[model samples]
Target: MIATFGGGCFWCTEVIFQHTKGVKEVLPGYMGGQRENPTYEQVCSGATGHVEVIQIDFDESQVSFQDLLEVFFKTHDPTTLNRQGADVGTQYRSVVFYHDDKQKQEAEAFIQALEEAKVYDSPIVTAVEPAVTFWEAEDYHHDYFNQNPQNQFCQVVIAPKLQKFLKLYQQ
Candidate 1:
């Protein structure tokens, strides 16, 4: 099964899903954009209407979609619009590109449950959109955190975030 989520940087999201047990492969890509074959630079400019997302191919029998949703919600800020930490832009917006009606219903229900439970201080702004073209990111962007561990952004932003996710999800 495939699941697509955009919650802040693709690098950050990629790290979270890559560590997940049932996730077979996670591809960092851009979606919900107008342009075809959008480049990282173009998406960063926030002009292509694309959001940095991960196209996750997971084993549903091993990990349910709801479990993946739990990770998705807990890993990033869904309340803030088009922003996460120091990264701010439309390309960084929170979204779920559902592939089918079932995913759409589940996502909506999950958000409703969160709202009812008062998960965040503010209203959730995560967009639930139909899955669209997934333009894979440039070759260099793949496995970025592992490849660029010494990079300042990875050290300052991603490392700590990944640590928190590990602590929360690791058994």
Candidate 2:
């Protein structure tokens, strides 16, 4: 099964799902956009209508979609519109690009449940949209956090966030 999500920077989202069990692959890319073959710079400009998303291929037998959903919510702030941490723009907006009706329904219901429970202090602004064309990002973006661990952004932002996720989900 495949799930595509846009919660924040692709690198940040990529690292989290990469550590998840049963996640066969996590590919960073552009989705929810009208532009064809958008580059990272173009997406970063936030003018292409693209959101930085990771298309996760997972084995449902080993890990359920619900489990992924839980991890997704816990790792990123869905209440904030068009932003996660200091990364602000439409590309960082919270969204689930569902590949099928089941996925769409599940995504919507997940967000609904979170809203009903008042999971966040603010209203959930996650968009559960149909999955569109996924333009695979440049090769350099794949496994970015793992490859660039020495970089400050990876150390300061991604590393801490990844540790927090591991503690919550892996423990």
Candidate 3:
């Protein structure tokens, strides 16, 4: 199964899915954009209409889409618009790019359930849309937290988020 999500920086989203038990591949990419084959620099300019995303291929037998949605809501602040932590701009918007009708329905139901449950202190503003062109980010963006743990963003932001995920959903 395929699950694409955009929640703030692709670096952090990619890292989180990579550690999930059933995930087969977590690729950093750009989606929901107008530009064709947008480059990292171009998307960063905030003109391409693309949001940084992670395309995850996972084993459905091992993990459900609902489970992934749970993790997604927990890891990022969905209340904020076009931002996650220090990452800002429309490129950092929270979104789920569903690959099929079933996925789309599930995503919508999940969002509704979260709202009814009051999962967040504020309203959840995650966007659920049909899957579009997924342009993989430049190779340097992959596994960024693993490769650059010493970086200030990794140490102060990504690391704590990863730790929280592990504590909440240990394999």
Candidate whose lDDT is highest = 1
C-alpha lDDT values of all predictions: 0.95, 0.94, 0.91
Tens-digit lDDT track of model 3 for 27-118: 99999999999999999899999999999999999999988988888888889999998788999999989999988999899889989998
lDDT of prediction 1: 0.95
Model 2 ranges with Cα > 4 A deviation: none
TM-score of 2: 0.98
Model 2, 166: alpha-carbon shift in Å? 0.9
- lDDT minimum window of 10 residues, candidate 2: 162-171
Q: What TM-score do all the candidates reach, one by one?
A: 0.98, 0.98, 0.97
Give the least accurate 10-residue stretch of model 1, judged by summed lDDT. Answer: 162-171
Q: Sorted by lDDT, highest first, which candidate order results?
A: 1, 2, 3
What's the distance in Å from true for residue 112, model 2?
Answer: 0.9
Candidate 1 on 1-171: residue-level lDDT in tens? 999999999999998899999999999999998999999999999999999999999999899999999999999999999999889999999999999999999999999999999989999999999999999999888989999999999999999999999999885
